[model samples]
Target: MANTSSAKKMVRKIERRTAVNKARRSRVRTYLRKVEEAIAAGDSTGAQDALKVAQSEMQRAVGHGIFHKNMASRKMSRLSGRIKAIGA
Candidate 1:
């Protein structure tokens, strides 16, 4: 569908970016799942540890433009609140 060479090149670039973004999204989800599992198991320390890793990954994602800034912040806030509630 891309007629021009530039358009074809752009399509290729888009494909590559899509794959990278998918991987990043999956990575973030994996970290989130780990934190949720730890929390569900009622392991406060483990959840805290997982939260640290997850937070880092999430912020990295935000920096990469995979997630909106506000969305990442909200997710981090909710996760932190859950961890705190479990601890308390």
Candidate 2:
């Protein structure tokens, strides 16, 4: 469907970027899930550690433009809050 050679190249670039973004997103989700699982298991220390890793991954996602800055901040805030509430 691309009419020009440049257009075809653009399509290829988009596909490559999409795959990279998808992998990044998946990695971020895995980090978040680890935190959630730790929280569910009531291991505050493990949850805290996982939350730290998740926060780092989320920030990386924002830096890479895979997620909005505020979105990542909000998620980190909520996850931290949950981590705090776990032992209280």
Candidate 3:
């Protein structure tokens, strides 16, 4: 479908970027899952630790353009709130 050499190069770049983005997304999800599991288990300290890591990963993702800034903030907020509620 790519007629020009430039277009072909663009296609290849996109493929590479897609694979990278997919890996980043999966990594973020894994961190989130770890936090969620810790929270569900009612381990406040573990959840807090995981949340810290997850938040770091999320912010890194935002920096990498994988997630919107607001979305990352919202997710971090919700996770922090949940962790706070664990003690209440």
Clashes of each: 0, 0, 0
Off by over 4 Å in 2: none
TM-score of 2: 0.97
1 against 2, candidate with superior lDDT:
1
Residue 54 lDDT (model 2): 88
What is candidate 1's TM-score against the reference?
0.97
Clashing residue pairs in candidate 1 are none
lDDT of 3 by residue, 1-88 (tens): 9999999999999999999999999999999999999999999999999999999999999999999999999998999899899978
Quote each prediction's TM-score: 0.97, 0.97, 0.98
TM-score ranking from best candidate downward: 3, 1, 2
lDDT of 1 by residue, 16-86 (tens): 99999999999999999999999999999999999999999999999999999899999989988998999
lDDT for 22 (candidate 1) = 100
What overall lDDT goes with each candidate model? Answer: 0.96, 0.93, 0.95
Worst 10 residues of 1 by lDDT: 72-81
Model 1 clash tally? 0
Lowest lDDT 10-residue stretch of candidate 2: 75-84
**Would you list the clashing residue pairs of candidate 3?**
none
